[model samples]
Each structure stands twice: as C-alpha cells, then as structure tokens.
Target: MKIFYFTGTGNSLYVAKRIGAEVYSIPQMIKEGRYEFEDEAIGFVFPCYGFGMAKMISNYIKKSKFKSNYFFAIMTYGGKSASGLHNMEEIAAKSGIHFNYTNEIMMVDNFLPAFEMESEIKNKSSDEIEKKIVQIEKDISARKNQLIRKGVASDVLSKYVHKIADNVSKNFAYKQIKVNDSCNGCRVCEQVCPANNISVTKTPEFSHHCEACLSCIHHCPQNAMHLKSEKSKARFINPNIQLKEIINANCQVK
Candidate 1:
C-alpha cells in the first residue's frame, strides 16, 4: 500500500503516517516532477480547503494517473468537510479514476481568519480523533467500499461555504502574506512553503505561486509571518507532528 499526502502544519501527514503506508509527500513529488504512479493499493490523504480539496491536490488528480487495484482517500478538516470528498471524486472521475473508500476526520481548523487557533486547539480532543483514525486504518486494510456522497443540500451549502473562503485559494501571493519587524531572517517560511513561493533575505519575500497553506505563518519561530486578516495571534502545528517533518514534507529546496 502507498499513500500520497499534502499537508500544512502536519495534520494530513500525521493521518497518512498513522495508516501505516509508504507515504510520499504530494508537494515533494510535484517539485521533483514525479507524477505517474501505480500500486496494489493507493490512497490520498489531505486537508480540505474551501469546502473542497486543495487546488494542488485537485490539479494533480486531474492531470496525473494513479493505477491501483484499490484506491482510498482520507480528508482532514478543522471545521466542516461538507462535500469535499465528493468534490475530489468528481476530479478523479474526470481522469477515469475512482476511490474504493473515502472518509473524513475532524481536526483543528487552521483557517486563521475565521477560526482562532487557540480556541480551535483547545476545543478539539485528540483522543477521539485517534479512535477515528484507527477505525479508518482498519477500514482501508479491509478494502472498504464506502464512498462519501452527500445529497444536493450538502452540495449547495458547500458551494456557498467555498465561495466565502475562495480568497484563501487565490494566487495573489505578494498581496497576501505580511511579515513584521520581529522577523530574525530565520527562513523557516522558505523551508516550510509547499509551493516554493518564499525566498528570504533579511525578511521573507513572497513569490507569485503561493499555495496559501499557512505553513510559513504557523511554523515561524519568531511569530513574524502573518495574514493581514488573521483572527488571533496564536499559531498551530499538529501536536503529533514535529517541525522537521513538515519541512521534509513540503520543502521545495530539497
């Protein structure tokens, strides 16, 4: 079994690791120009953005080929997953692929503008999350045939929710991130950026290819990187993951 994942702040990577598969970073694969894949069983683990899969994930699914006897997906979300899994299905189907199993696990929502990181961290209990992940692992091992499909009501609501958070998906990189004087030129932002969109010289500079995954803002030790509309000053990285793991997962510099 093999799993491909995209992560910011480590949530999806944690889940992918817990599933006991040969895990590969989606960003790293893209950076290395590795696209075509085949396996006895394959899966994708990623965070939901704008009530759908991240644009990077969606684009990869649309263009690449994943040949497998069984396919699965696990979505990690802080708030509502809504129809994110279904949205992913549509993208894969367009490429003549389908998943054998799909599931979602709720984790801290890292959308800094709407969800306060402190509150999101405090409110979610990881114990319950662990239980869900264990069950998902068992299901995948058994090759479960469930596919997550909500009806029209969910599709309608998902579109509305997605529209509200669409800017998070936009490519206005230079205009999005804000860095302050507290920065010490550490370059953690450049290392953590999945899009290869940051370069540091005394302060980090945004390239036009921002994925807006917030890895830079959340992982900055100096707490200097930020969004202009962030809710609170608090930052978040998944408790089960370490800083080096994320850098290894998304770092474009190799």
Candidate 2:
C-alpha cells in the first residue's frame, strides 16, 4: 500500500503514517513530476478545505496515473467535512477510479476565521483522536470496503456547497494570507509551504496560485501570518508532529 498526502499542520500526515503505508508527500510528488505509481493499494489522505479537497489535491488526482486494484481515501477536518468526501468521489470518477473505501475523521478545527483555535485545541481530546485513528488503522489493515454516504440532506447540501466554495476559494482564499511585521525573517513559512507559494527575502511573499492550506500561518513560529479577517487568532500545529517533519515533507523536492 502507498498513501499520498498533503497537509497544512500535519493532521493528514499523522493519519497517513498511522495507516502503515509507504507514505509519499503530494507536493514532493508533483514537484518531482513522478505521478505514476504502481501499488496493490493506493490511498489519498488529505485535509478537507472549505468543504472539499484542497485545490492541489484535486489537480494531482486529475493529472496522475495510477495502476492499482484497490483505491481509498481518508479526509480529515476540524468541523463538518460536508461535501469533501463526495467531492473526492467525483474527482475519482472523472479519472475512472473507484474508491473501495472512504471515510473522515474530525480533528482540531484550525480554520481560524470560523473557529477559535484556543477553544478548539482545548476541546480536541487526545483520547478521542486515538480511538478514531486506531479504528482507521485496523480498517485499512483489513482492507475494509465501506463507503461514506452523506445522507439525503447532506448530499443535497454538498451539490452546491463545493461549487460556491470553489468560486470563493479561487478568488479569495489564498489572497487573504499575509505576513505582519512580527515575521522575523526566519523563512520557516517559506520552507513549510506545500504549494511553494511563499518566497521569503526580507519577509514572505505569496504567489497568486496558493492553495490556502494555511500551513504557513499555523506553523509560523512568531504567529506572524494572518488572513484578511484582520483579527488576531491563535495558531495551531499538530502537537504530535515536529516542525522539522513539516519542513522536510513540503520543502524537499525529491
């Protein structure tokens, strides 16, 4: 089994690692132009962004070629996953890929605009997380074949949710992230950006093509990055992951 993952603050990476697969970073895979992989089982583990998979993940799924008999996906989100799993199914359908299993796990809500990080962190218990991960690990080891269904109401909601979010995301999501004066020129943001959308000289600069994964904002040591909300929100990094792991996962081209 091989799992390809993209993470902002390492939630997805942690999940991928726990699944006992040969893990591969999505950004690294794209940068190296090595999209073709052969495995008996192929899986994607990523965070849900605005009720859907990250823009980069969708693009990667569309462009990549895979030879696998079994395919699956795991989506991690802080709040409602909404249409994220549904969106992944659609993208896979486009490429003639049918998922044998799909599911989601709720984690610390890090979308600063919607959730207060301090409160969410306190509420996200370690015991709860372990229970979920252990079950997922067992399921994957057994090659479980369950699929996630969003019920009638959720299915109806998902149809328009992603379409609306797509427009908003393309126009607004990435544009809002900005570095303040507190940025110490450490360049940690630059190194951890999975999209490689940030470049740091005196301070960090953003490219137009950011995926808005929020890795830079959450991982900035100085808490220097903020969105247009113009309010100071607490930053969050998965405590189980190291900053070195994030930097290495994203920055290393090969």
Candidate 3:
C-alpha cells in the first residue's frame, strides 16, 4: 500500500504512519513527476483545507496516472471535514480512479486565526481523535461501508467556501518570517518545508509559493521563525507531532 499526503501540523502524517504503508508527500511527487506503485492499495492522507482538499493534492491527482485496485482517503480536520471527502471523490472520478473508502478524523485545530483551542482541550481532543482513527482503520480493513453522502446544498456551500479560500490564498500577501536575536540557524525549517519555500541565507527566506502550511513556523528548532502578528505569541504547534517523526515516517524512496 502507498499513502500520499501533505501535512502541516502532522495530523495527516500520524495517520499515514499508523497505516504502515509507503507514503509520499504530494508536493514532492508533483515536482518530480514520478509515479510508480508496486502496492495494490493506494491512499491519500491530508488535512482538510477550506472545506475541501488542498490544491497540491488536487493538482497531483489531475496530472498523475496510477494503476491500483484499491483507492482510499483519510482526511484529518480540526473541526468538521465538511465536503472535503466529496471534493476528493470528485477529483478521483475525474482521474478515472474509484475510491473504495473515504474517512474523516478530527484533530487539533492548528489554524490559529480561524480556530483556536485551549491547550487542555486540544490534548484531550487529539486523544479522542487517535481513537477515532483506529476505528477508521478497522473499518477499512474489513471493507465496510465508507462513502458519506453530501447533499446538493452542502456541496454548493462547500464549493463556494473553497473558491473564496483559493482566492484568499493566492492574493493575500504573507507576513515575513523573522528570526529573533536568540538564533542559531540550524536550518531545520528549510529542511522540513514541503513546498521548498524556505532557504537559509543570512537568515531564512520565504519563497513566493508559500502554502501557509506553517511547517517551517512550527518546526523551527531554535524557535526562530515568527509571523508579524500579535497571534504569533499565542500560536502553538501540536506537541504530539515531532519533526523527526514527520521526516522519518516512510514517505517515498529517493
């Protein structure tokens, strides 16, 4: 089995590792244009962005060709998944692939401006989420009922939300990432960025294709990267996810 994913705070990575399948990051796969799967089962694991799938995942699915008997997806959301699964299914259909399973798991909301949770609540919620994921895995193993129907109204609303988010993501000017005086440039942020958006100059520099995935902001070893907002102080990364785990989790072989 092969699981392809794009993770920011590592909720998607956690699920991918637990499945014990070969994993690939969608951004890396898209950039390299390499698609060779020996596994019969193929899966996508990603966070629900803007009530739908991430643009990276959608673009990869649209362009890449794969031969596999089983196709599945496991989407992790901070709150509600909404029409994320539906959007992915639509993409799969366009790609001429049939999805055998689609599942959603609620994880800690790391999107600071939109949603914030108390530390205690976040910890408790993550524990509950892991339990739900275990159940989802069992269901997939048994080949049980997997598809969740989305009503026409829900689909329309989700599409509208996704459109707004896409515009915002593309048009919005991002705040510069600053490293404080207490800095030793370990270059961890540059290494972990899935977009290849960060580089170690005198300090770290952000490239134009910032997915706002915050992998750099969250994984900085020296606590160096910061956004120019008051929320920067309050913003927290999920403690359960480590950068080493994210990297070491089997994605793909070079």
Candidate 4:
C-alpha cells in the first residue's frame, strides 16, 4: 500500500500518517518526476480546496499512472465536506481507475481568507480527531467501499463551484503573498515552497505558478511571510507534524 498526500499546514499529512501506509509526498513526487507506482492498494490523501481536490492533486491524477486493484482517497475538511468526495470519484473515473473507497475527516481549516485558524482549532479536540482516524483506519484495513452520494443538487453545485473557484484561486490566490520587513532573507520560504514558486534574494520572490499551499507562510521563523495586510492573523501548523518533517516532505526528493 502506498498513500500519496498533499498538504499545506500538515493537516492532510497527519491524516496520511495515521492511515499507516507507506506514505509518499505528492509534491516531492512531482518535483522528482515520479508518476508511476504499482501497489496492491493505492490512496490519495489531501485537504479539500474549495470543496474539491487541491489543484496539484488533480494535476497529479491527470499525469500519473498507477496499477492497483484498490484505489481510495481521503479528504480532510474544516467544515462541511461539500462535494469533494464526489469530485475525487469523477477524477478517478477520468483516470480510468475505479475509486473503491472515499471519505472525509474534519480538521482545522487553514484557508486564511475565510477561516480563522484560532477559532477553527477550538472546534475539534484531540479525542475527536483520534476517533475519526480510528474509524477511517478500520475501514481502510477492511478494504470497505463507499459510493459517492451527494444527490443531484450537490453534485451539480460542486462541479460548477469547484471549477470556477479553482480557476479564480489559481490565478490570484498567491499574488498577494509577500515578505514583510521582518524578513532577514533566510531563504526558508523559497526552500519550503512545494511548487518551486518562491526564490529568495533580498526577500522572497513569488512566481505565478504557486499552489497556495502556504507552507512558506506557516514555516517562516521570522513570521515575515504574509498575505495582503494579514500580519495580524495567527498561523497554524498541525501539532502532530514537526517543522523538519514538513521540510523533508516538501523540500527533499526522497
């Protein structure tokens, strides 16, 4: 079994770790040009973006090849999962793979535009997360199948909303990210960016290809990275994940 995961602030990584599979970082896979894997069971683990798969994960699904008897996806969301599971089902179908199991886990929402990190963390306790993970682990171990059922209204809404929102987000979401005066040109942001979208000189330079994962923002030691006028908002990184782990997952090839 191999679990492919994409994470921003480590929420998805935490869930992926709990799944107890040989985990592979999707960002590192893309960076190293690794797109083919053969395993008995294959899994995609990632956080939902705008009620759908993250753009990088979707792109990986399109470009990668896999040989597996069972394929599953686990999505983490901070609120209502909306139609992300359904969306993953469609992506799998398009990839000529049948999605065997799909599920969602509630976690802290780090989408800074809409969710306040401090408040979202208060919504779920450690016991709650462990309970959810236990259920997911049992189901995955049993190879249980879950059919995506969002009804007609939800299916239609998710399709259009995800398409439009993903497009808009990709175009403008990372545009406002800038290194403030507190930056000492540490180059941490450039090194941690999963997309290879940041370069450090006097400060950080951002490219237009950013995935908006915010790894740089949260991992910056100086707290120098911020969106437009966002210096006041608190930052979040999953407590179960360490800074070195994130750096290795996002920055190292192996």
Best by TM-score: 1
The residue ranges of model 2 lying beyond 4 angstroms of the native Cα positions read 170-174, 230-232, 252-254
RMSD over all Cα atoms, model 4: 2.0
lDDT of 3 at 13: 80
Candidate 3 lDDT over 21-86, as tens digits, reads 787877667666775554678888988888887676787788778778788888887766778788
- Please report the TM-score between candidate 2 and the true structure: 0.93
Model 3, residue 98: distance off in Å is 2.0
Steric collisions counted per model: 0, 0, 1, 0
The full ranking of all candidates by TM-score, starting with the best, is 1, 4, 2, 3
Decide which is better by lDDT, 1 or 3: 1
Q: Model 4, residue 138: what's the lDDT?
A: 95
lDDT of 4 by residue, 1-254 (tens): 99999887888899999999899998889888899899999998988777787787888888989999999888998877888888887887887878898888888877676777778877778788889899989998999998657788888888888888677665443577766799999877776677777777788876677776778888889988777845246888999998777877777322
**Poorest 10 consecutive residues by lDDT, candidate 1:** 164-173
lDDT of 2 by residue, 8-108 (tens): 89899999998898999988888888878889999999998877887888899899888888889999998888768988988988987899989899898
Candidate 4's displacement at residue 123, Å, is 1.9
Best-fitting candidate, measured by lDDT?
A: 1
lDDT of the structure predicted as candidate 3: 0.71
What overall lDDT, based on C-alpha atoms, would model 2 receive against the true structure? Answer: 0.83
The TM-score between candidate 3 and the true structure equals: 0.85
**What are the C-alpha RMSDs, in order, of all predicted structures?**
1.7, 1.9, 3.2, 2.0
